[model samples]
Target: MERNAVEERVAQHYAGGIYAPDRAPEDMAIQSDTLFMFLMGEAGQREDMEAWMVRMAEAMDRIQELMDVLEARAEEKEESGAA
Candidate 1:
């Protein structure tokens, strides 16, 4: 395919970028790793992004539990303010 043909097709099919509330399209940001992760998860499921999002929430919950455990253990230890 020629470069001009590719460009024409992309222009014809392109929808638009998703932007945050009160933000312009130019201000939109994307994390490539997270985007690819969500896409891969969606590929495996029949539904759209909900199942992947639930898994994301569960993973975050597990991380928060680990953080709370660490905080509790730190509180039990004496803090030395040595220079």
Candidate 2:
């Protein structure tokens, strides 16, 4: 499906009252056993472990960049009283 269509579908599903958007994320650290299993599953996916590490690093970097952009926009709005 196209990106817009997929987004619209997700919005519709959210509007249908399935998920609670106000839910808070848990602030919990990973346990050793869970970490070990996650690492093993990632390693099992590929011949080289570096590939998995690189993919995870890239995803983290993208998330950080998005957060920075949002923060900057929020600061701008606060300064300008645009909102």
Off by over 4 Å in 2: 1-45
Cα-lDDT of candidate 2: 0.50
Question: What's the alpha carbon RMSD for model 2?
Answer: 16.0
For 2-68, candidate 1 gives per-residue lDDT tens digits of 2233223322332342312222223334243355334333434424345555765777898899999
The residue-by-residue lDDT of candidate 2 on 19-46, one tens digit each, is 2232222313313335433443454454
After the best TM-score superposition of candidate 2, give how far the Cα of residue 21 lies from its true spot, in angstroms. 29
Best by lDDT: 2
Please list the Cα RMSD from the true structure of every candidate, rounded to 1 decimal place. 10.8, 16.0
lDDT, candidates in the order shown: 0.44, 0.50
Clashing pairs in 2: none
